[model samples]
Target chain A: MAPKYVLHYWPSIPGRGEYIRLAFEATGTAYTESNEPKTLLKHVMSCSKVGHPPHFAPPVLEIQLEAARSTKSRKTETSEDVKSSSPFFLSQTPAILAYLAPHLGLDGVKKGKNEEDPEVDQIRRAQVNQITLTILDLNSEVHDSHHPVASSAYYEEQVPEAKKRAEDLRKVRLPKFLKLFEETIASNEDEDHLYGSSLTTADLALFQLIDGIQFAFPKRAAALEKSGKYAKVFALKQAVAKLPKIKAYLESERRLPYSDGIFRHYPELDGED
Target chain B: MAPKYVLHYWPSIPGRGEYIRLAFEATGTAYTESNEPKTLLKHVMSCSKVGHPPHFAPPVLEIQLEAARSTKSRKTETSEDVKSSSPFFLSQTPAILAYLAPHLGLDGVKKGKNEEDPEVDQIRRAQVNQITLTILDLNSEVHDSHHPVASSAYYEEQVPEAKKRAEDLRKVRLPKFLKLFEETIASNEDEDHLYGSSLTTADLALFQLIDGIQFAFPKRAAALEKSGKYAKVFALKQAVAKLPKIKAYLESERRLPYSDGIFRHYPELDGED
Candidate 1:
């Protein structure tokens, strides 16, 4: 029997958790996701008390292994320790993805000796990781657009500053990041994927980023996509959208619409293209 | 002979480079660092053109491997291909530290089967990584205190908004993060290190963070340290500071002062304890 996997994340917003879901959906992996936001928050808050590794934030994946059955023979045990033996939990999105991708065949290829440039594999994977980090940085910048002065403060209290941040993100940082991604895609002349010939988690992440950007800054994302400058990026997004599993997931109820997420669609924040 | 390691970062500011430097200094590793700002910028800019992995920012580590010497016999001699064989570069501070820590013996121990809780090692390392990332997150928040509205703009342009961000950070966020670090330290029982019984890169990173916080917000950091709430965290800082190499590095010219770094000492931002 296949081991059971449970993912705990806020059900309403497809924020950072959506990145993990994309990999699972793309690979046709079976996993259950917690749907209650309050329960998810409670679990994250109490992660340390249960002797599980303290997760600073959520999108935690709990993996139940076959080895857990042996734990029944132990004499002295609490509920948490009993579960701890066979089922381990991992937190932090990137760490979880890196751990899972290798097992799921979604990681970069381990090139052979006969390959023309076998050394490029290490560098390729490192670059993929770098690009992924840059994407997260961009995601943070997008979040800051609305919460510029203080995350503790509401959007209404920081309207003027939000406008300033949105303007910089729109005019300066957005174009800069788009160009960087566009250049990376263009580097692989023959393939639509972000890394190598086959799809990796980085490609999936890139697709999600493009998707979120389109939803958040409709006018700007549309104008940029139409500009012909980032042709490869636009092409990759279309390609990812058409993948059979991804297409199905997008059409299904599982795919939550963008509202209160890292990439938010605020009409005031979205300037003219 | 060991491989030559060269670190490239901004000359004046400790910035992100300080994290990498802490590991090297604590372990007494010998590595050269570039001091000229123009050369550092040029190297970072040309990273892509050289066919090496492009670092989006500085604190790039260049490793020249002895294994790379075998490539001389290969017929393919493009400049990019030639350089790719002998020397490789890694960027992004967290990734660099993760890659180097194992070689420097600063990584967590691989527990034996006889150990009571062998399963804890994996969880331990993941939590350490999480803490390191959280430290970076705090570092970013500290930076935003000085440049709340625009990073591209000068500090003078965003003074008013910076004050608001600083007030929130000094009063709310700083205490919250200090409390988190304090809780983590207290979890280790009698140990002075952040994890297990010995020192790991996370401890060095924690030390750097405490050092920077003290420099950037002297009034607040000193008060927190004196209040005795974070006793273990303060003890860890003292322990790391007394490490022979680290103490030498601190008193030497190589340990650059905190000017124009992520954690700048703005008098207004310091506020009160």
Candidate 2:
């Protein structure tokens, strides 16, 4: 039986949760991709769920584990008996991705189950973790382009600062990240994926990372594309887009574009050199 | 034989690597503690060691592994025998701890070699990762204490914006983090440790987190500590201070206090109210 994955993300834009969605899609996994913002809001507002909640934000993955509840245990029950019928819900996209990847057979590790080889799994997961960490860093960098002056303050208030920072960010950090990816691809003996020569979730993740960067910094990215070092990365990204599952999802109303999400484009924040 | 730990750190302060150091001390593990900062710099700087061709900051843990060394039969003498030797360095503190915990018997399920228990490890690790993430966020908040207005600008350049952001930060986020920790301890069944009962690295980490917060925001912490909900947490901090290895190390010339590291104090940033 194919495992069903219900990925709950914000309806508006493809933010952090898109990585998980992409991985599930790439592997041809059966999953419910729901972007019901109302559903997400309800979960976030709930007391049991929002324990030590975020300072501000949404896009939580609500996971439902449906197994045959033991009818034998239900006959006589104490307060702690019967066992939780309602499934587990976790926030934090990185944590959720780390949790889910192995279950989907996309991660190739013992992962959460501990059934497979851990030594190998540890290395694999570490590689995955490294990729995600880089993605998170990239996301933060994109956010910084608009709110470079103050994360708490309005972007309008810091437009001057943003103008200054965006110049160096585009020229310095953008190329650095690209060249890093280029070198990573160049280092790979295999033509296909990032780690152990398999199409792990990391590549799917890097696609989102680069895609988001390109969306936000088109003027800068265009200059970069002309430089021609990241052809393999760009090719992999195009190939990922061409996947039938991904193509269908993109065509569907569910797939979101970059606007008011983690990757926001501000033409004023753009600087060309 | 007792597991040997080759901790790669700055040789200056117990920043992120302190968590591992604390674990080693608590267990009384017999191992070589090489405090070679220059050696660390050299190893991390070497492109041949890491796959991506540069350093990802300091403090990489080196583990020795022997692989089958997959090489074709003709091999052509392997083009100068390009292969890594006995030691393998793992970056990121969380990655290193995950590698060492099982070996040190700090892990719960000791099913011996090849034991694949991911849940027992994952729950604890996820919790640990959450705290580490929180601490990093908190440290960034600490950075805001000095340069709240911008990352690109130096401390002196953004003093005005820093002051206002720091004031708002002290009044709001500082208390929020402390209260969360207080609540975590008060609500936990195992009050001593933040994660599931007993002295896992998470408890020591929380102590470090709190200690850093206290050091960085003395006045705000004083106000927060008045709640008295973190009695066990405070006790754990005290207990860690008294640990023979930690105590000796602390008394030795080795342990250094906060400066420009992750946790820093800006007199203007903190407030009593």
Candidate 3:
């Protein structure tokens, strides 16, 4: 049976697709990931559906409304309903996450009297997105540490520059970003989440970011973890890992390993504290 | 009287904040930008308000609800209303833009009977955000062309790596992104906008992205423009610039010049196509 949600990305490494995957896995939602290169290429290279524009890159989400399945028996369905029920494609990791977060119940809900207020909902959504964007920004910087010259070029080709970039990332950037997350987590009343008193897409994104950093920069990540300053952040990572569904997914075959993806384990790039 | 929107960013140079400024200018909205370094630093460096978290970087938007002004006369106002009317600080350029776009009427409106459908609204918002994010991704790459190793380091410190990065950007990445935008614009029924049949924050974002690219890489930008391949994109840029308020703002003192910001013009970095 075709799932309601389909994810099209590179077949091999997790890359940015993992952020989307984590959201689904955490929520125990059923989603289909296109692991076949040919099928994936066709969907990503062009507009697979009418009314959808071409995607610039991978990690695209195609959402088919459930009502479309029952449309065969319903004679009252209008053209507008048919168009609305058609498969909708969206790209950009953050954009996909934001769209899915609310549906997945990861975009924290407002409490009490403000529950019905759109302004409160908007503020909550923006806060979650801002934190997710910051995590991704650091994730981009991590990728650059190894491929500083050009992402197209191999790390071996840019070793000298990579060394400089990785050194700065370890000595300056990583700590700065980690501290910001630490402060942010401390600010929230709930110690386990990045936003409100709940697990949000931002928390899932942060978990993946720290997991990638650990894979890419073990020595630096270890030192920072040992420092105890980012206790809240590490706690959140542990909390996310311990989620029943997320744990099952991580140990399952669906979770791809890090290789030549954005978060790469290059020994020379890792530095001691 | 204070404007409803307060923009906090660096005092000089048209950086990411310019994207937000263009949205306001194009809509003729009243906004105050904090030009003093100290005032701006205070808002960005710490949580200026009790409920807000510390911003990771600049381009933070402080939105004060209008109901707060009439609170003195409204004796029946509840505490929930007071809290909702408090100033909300949001960071992240795309987040700020997404939050402001709908209010500015740049998120695009549905013209048909499906207008009331929340799913339709969500899809439209995601499309606008996805395009805006893609443009910003290209913009980030342009910034990296000059400061390939580290954003904190001076461009002079990484000139060797900058050359290689800029070469890839000018010859490969820039053209690839431009082609995608061109295809997207052509895909739309309205040739002037990137998404629907109207001006959106995505269009405003694309205009600023191209404007900064032209300023930073004159040779490559001019070659691409003269190639006439991306006719729709350039036409869109021209359309955005010719907006009555945008034209006036561009000529006003409020619009800062490009300097040592994200899009820097190092003659050595700008290469021939």
TM-score winner:
3
Give the per-residue lDDT digits (tens) of candidate 1, residues B214-242. 99999988888888888888888889999
Give i-RMS (Å) per prediction: 3.9, 4.9, 2.6
Q: How much of the true A–B contact set does each candidate keep?
A: 0.24, 0.06, 0.55
Give the range where candidate 2 chain A is weakest over 10 consecutive residues by summed lDDT. Answer: A65-74
Q: Give the per-residue lDDT digits (tens) of candidate 2, residues A1-273.
A: 222456667777787778777877777766786667776666553434434222123445544433322332233433242233224345555556666666665563533443332443555576566555555666666776676545667878878667756776787677666665665556555546554455666677777887887888788777777778777778777776777777887788767777887787888776567
Model 3, span A19-86: residue lDDT tens: 99999999989888876877666656365344556788888888876454345424545666666546
DockQ of each: 0.37, 0.22, 0.55
Docking class of 3: medium
Q: What value does the lDDT take at residue B10 in candidate 2? A: 78
lDDT of predicted model 2: 0.60
Tens-place lDDT digits, model 3, residues B21-125: 999999989988876888777766465344556688889888876554345424545666667546778899988888787788888656564454557577778
Assess the local accuracy of residue B214 in candidate 2 as a C-alpha lDDT between 0 and 100: 83
TM-scores for all predictions: 0.88, 0.80, 0.94
lDDT of 1: 0.74
List candidate 1 stretches off by more than 4 Å: A1-4, A45-48, A66-86, A111-125, A188-191, B45-48, B66-86, B111-124
Share of the reference A-B contacts seen in candidate 1: 0.24
Docking class of 1: acceptable
- Residue B108, candidate 1: how far off, in angstroms? 2.0
Docking band of candidate 2 = incorrect
What is candidate 2's TM-score against the reference?
Answer: 0.80
